[model samples]
Target: NRADGFASDSVTVLDPAAGTLTFLSEAAKLAVEEFVSRYGEGGKENFIKEHILKNFYAFELMMAPYTVGHLKMSFLLEELGYRLQDDDRFKLYLTNTLEMEELAQTELPGMASLSEESHLAGKVKKEQPVLVILGNPPYSGVSANRGKWIDDLLKKGYTRSDGYKDDGYYQIDRKPLGERNPKWLQDDYVKFVRFAQWKIDQAGEGVLGFITNHGYLDNPTFRGMRQSLLNSFNEIYILDLHGNSLKKEKCPDGSKDENVFDIQQGVAIALFIKKKGEKKDCKVYHSEIWGLREEKKYDWLLKNDIKTTDWRKLSPKSEFYLLVHRDESFLRSYEKYLKITEAFPLNSVGIVTSRDSFVIDSDKEALKRRIRMFRDEKMPDELVKQTFNLKDKSNWKLKVVREKVRKDEHWEDSITKILYRPFDIQWVFYHDNLIERPRKEVMRHMMEENLGLVSVRQVAEGIFNHAFVTDNIIESRVTLSNKGIAFLFPLYLYSDTDKKETGNPNKKRSLGSTMMLFEPKAEYTIKKPNLSPQLVERLTCQYKKTPSPEEIFYYIYAVLYSNIYRTKYAEFLKIDFPKIPFTKDYKLFSKVAEYGKRLVDLHLLKSVELDSPVAKFQGDGDERVEKLRYDGGEKCVYVNRSRYFEGITKEVWEYQIGGYQVCSKWLKDRKGRRLFLDDIKHYCKIVTSLQKTMEIQKVIDNIYPEAEKETIEFENK
Candidate 1:
């Protein structure tokens, strides 16, 4: 009948027209029946049924080949349809399996989930027809697994993976294992690029295109990832976004550009095309601007066409704030400006810490380099102190650090590992007024706990609590934290202008007859009033045998600023400045002035008195200070203060004694190191007040005049 199958199921077939007997012929059937009687004892009907079912079962067992073949055929058809019969056209595979989360659980624990082959099976072909494949892969960073899981996942095929077996592999570990080095894995994007390249090779065609995270371009964590990509793609296009730049519908409010401290991390997108084998040299075009609508032509941008200005160069805007160090023995406000704007430029000012020994903020690359150099530059003495020494870097310090990292510890074990190495050619800002701070630091309350002046607290919270207590917070006051104090120490130290007498090696130490030497304790009070009282007391005890009246004054000030005394002063001794009088009644005036000088000696006060008018009181570091008495006569007072400690008015002291002037003079003079404690405290107070005042003005208009008034008075001019 048909050339396709048996002619009939029930009858013995005979092709009489061709004169040949078929296997189903009557004679052949008789022989088959006899053979069955002799060997196949089972009935023919049962045997036939069993044989047919067995064959069907075998067919089902080999169904994988058919399914796989169908996929291959579909790919071929698609490639042919797309006219990809050539040998060098690019091919793409876009997989959509369980997404990044599921993959982290199944195959790549402790790592970001990535695109898989299931989704891409239909997208890719055995043959290539396109130049490149590229698109934004769906983001899978929002999984519930904390970074702990990612860390473990990174070690899945490495030694560390065994430590975290409970987490297990992702759900889509469908691929066969190969002799690949698991330690080489850096991140999801890296895996994506590598996998895509492998698929391109499978296609026996052109190159690959991948659009993924741009972090590899610069981030330290992605260094290895970057090297891998660099080896693959000759051309790279980077589109950097301000921190937290992703625009997602699920976001409550789209994030804006901000300091790294304000947000977790910065985000960017990248386009990569491999140029491993090519006839023409690869061309690269980079541009940040997208979706441009022009007069006639679509302004599609290439990197070469993009101007340098189009790329963002980060700088602190006028809105940025700077912490200054001025009068503290080692601090000043302008010095702070210099520190941020010049010394430690915004780009270079990585971070500061309250506890210097415990926490260090270093450049990531610098840290790595330092670690390498430190290892290489070791002398025998250095090696003796270490518990263990590495023979080579193959034993990744990451493992060592991880092992040394105490469970839930606050600080890292390696002390030298955390140091920050600044970039060569420290960042210098050519533009003046690069940043304008809207806020200024000021004193919160003066005359609190009978102390004439007190420092302010910052408006924002700090990492570590300030070591000292502060007075009440009014509308405007200076705010300094432990963090600020540590940051401004160098700047403040550079700005001390008061001259100091040093002992000659062969001569006995003696106080110079240079009128009055502001006690080191007083300078300290003026500089860092935030230091703890215990520390101040110890310094005072060491500096002077019987603390001078000024030292006594500073001691009292220190006691008041101590955490134990702040609440007491706030409740019992807090005084409104309005109550203090500036009268010349000798009994009151002498007592007040004596107490004031005592506080200065004790490092409790940051006060400097000036003549009411300028030229009349001018002298060689000396002046006769007069006060109005009840008798209507001028009561003469001796003024033997540092000539640099000038007062603008009876109530307003010049607290912002320029730091650069002081440092330059000190450097040029090259006299023995003289430390002033009061300058440090004064610097802190002035800068804090300046910052607070500026901040208040930013929030409320017309508040600066009043704020400035309080700040000036608190400066104790």
Candidate 2:
């Protein structure tokens, strides 16, 4: 069974037990002792004793039988001529690969004073020279491997500690990553990679290969990890298999692309090689494989080796050492513009109500009734959950919600309007205690009549189209697709003011005020514009005029809607918040601001231009939406088998905002519900608004080139 002229002792078969009967059975079938006992020359037992048993060494550590029956079955196979017997060379111990260093230091009870297998594994891990480490480790975001040894190793090399404090981790270059959430770095696959890297570093030189999630390739959060790998290895090879369905990825030729595995997240095979000397400057080579899973992915992997496949040399830069290609020229220009976050100093993510089913509803009365039931002490939690079809999550438990609600005396006052989706307004029970994440810091500004810009920080769908204006409280995903959360940047901030007695009792408070004192005294909340004073001053100096906050807000909105701006800097917009390039020309700024104001009014559905409808509701039925379909030839949208909206154009019907087909989504969300006269008129106005928006966008695009020609550059201070 041995190689020609090679001793059996030269090769050792070592594997961790899979804790399955199938693994044991397969191991017995493949053993050389079984072969010698079955068909060797002379007596079978004597031949195995003389040759097979004396030379062959196979150890299965971490042996764990699922049941007593499985344990008995293993012994039965050994008794029935399987020749599976434990000698000095064959020992089993319960060991975890990630914690070999800790396990090697501890002693475990066994037939002798200590487990020989444990001792050997410890010795191999601490003292042996491992030249190669390769495997497809498990991928779990909520990894179960939280041992102190592995966590310490990760802190030392790959990621920041739990408190997010930098403790001399080699992964960080000079500055902290400044990430609020880096939980993805704790994935089981990442831990395994870190472990392998540590082992190779201990040995001073080795090769590490693994197939893992491709998120780290360009994800802004993994800059440190990418830098750490670059610092440790001499050469790195990456074969990205782009097939992320969540991002709705497509091949270069617009063909359908699928993942090699049945997972929404894409994967890549990464190879890291370290030389046996001082670490050299790292050279990274990258390649991509796309198309069908079997033909393109599997066939290519089966056919090509590292030397055979083509690779493109990449030069990763500082700050964010992204693995993917970037347009350096475009990025250099884009970086000069003022970021939205810098322009607006105060902003926050929108409200996240974990129990959306129970807390939010289109009908205000229905929401009121649900709240009444929730506040009722007599109503059992289970019954209340059943009534609202509420499913308790780990964060939003019924018991906790009931206790919070029971203590609040003014829970009814928390009911308010929310922009649930694009052009879809709904009432939400907005209580900090009841809702999972109310985002009170920013949302309090929108409690009354206030304006806020809704946009996502990152674009995973390869587009920068999710931007809108809201005048009310917004849900976390109000206008987002692809699991992206929307952030709200309110134009003004509100704070409580002391109640002062006014002479007039019947005088109405200002439109934006939320609280009022009763009995002849009125209280008005103070409102302050949430704009950076320094930015305003810089723009004022550049334009020779002090621009109002509303003017700046509208100008930003117009810039975001420009087709040229979106297309030219699409890659830059994908990584972070959109930046606004201020035009030094006052005329261009005024024109763009005028258009932005019109768009804002149109989106809010308060524009005088919307008095005229482009589409008309025809046909007579129950007015209930059963299904929605559009006919291009007829230029009509059918709500059911009978009723349809006429005079609708194909462009208007297929219009999208925030990754949602507007005309269809509005109707689809109202399925099986009767549409009133106001609802019918509203749909027509929405169609008109979309048509106007498309026309306005083209107008902005025409003047965008002139606007970009003379831009204001702000000082770093």
In terms of lDDT, the best-performing candidate is 2
* Counted clashes in each candidate structure: 89, 0
Q: 1-717 in candidate 2: lDDT tens per residue?
A: 244211133322222222333433343335445454455634544433443334322223233443432464446445634455565222233456566543324453543323454566566556655555655666788978788877877665433212223332335566666665677778877777776676667666767777788877887677777877777778999999989998889997889999999999889999988776755689999999999999899999999999988998988877677787766667766677888877877888888887788889988898888788887899988998888787788767887878888787767667888998889889888887668888887887786457889887778775678889999889988766553578889986666441235432112246445542221122334666677766787777877877777888999999999989988988877777887888999888999999999999999999988898888999977789998889999999999988988888998888877877889999998999988888899899999898889999999999989999978875431
Q: What is the lDDT of residue 637 in candidate 1?
A: 14
Once fitted onto the true fold, the runs of candidate 2 whose alpha carbons sit more than 4 angstroms away are 1-94, 99-129, 155-173, 391-400, 496-525, 714-717
User: Candidate 1 lDDT (Cα, whole model)?
Assistant: 0.27
* TM-score for each candidate, following the candidate numbering: 0.25, 0.82
lDDT of each: 0.27, 0.73
> Which candidate has the top score in TM-score?
2
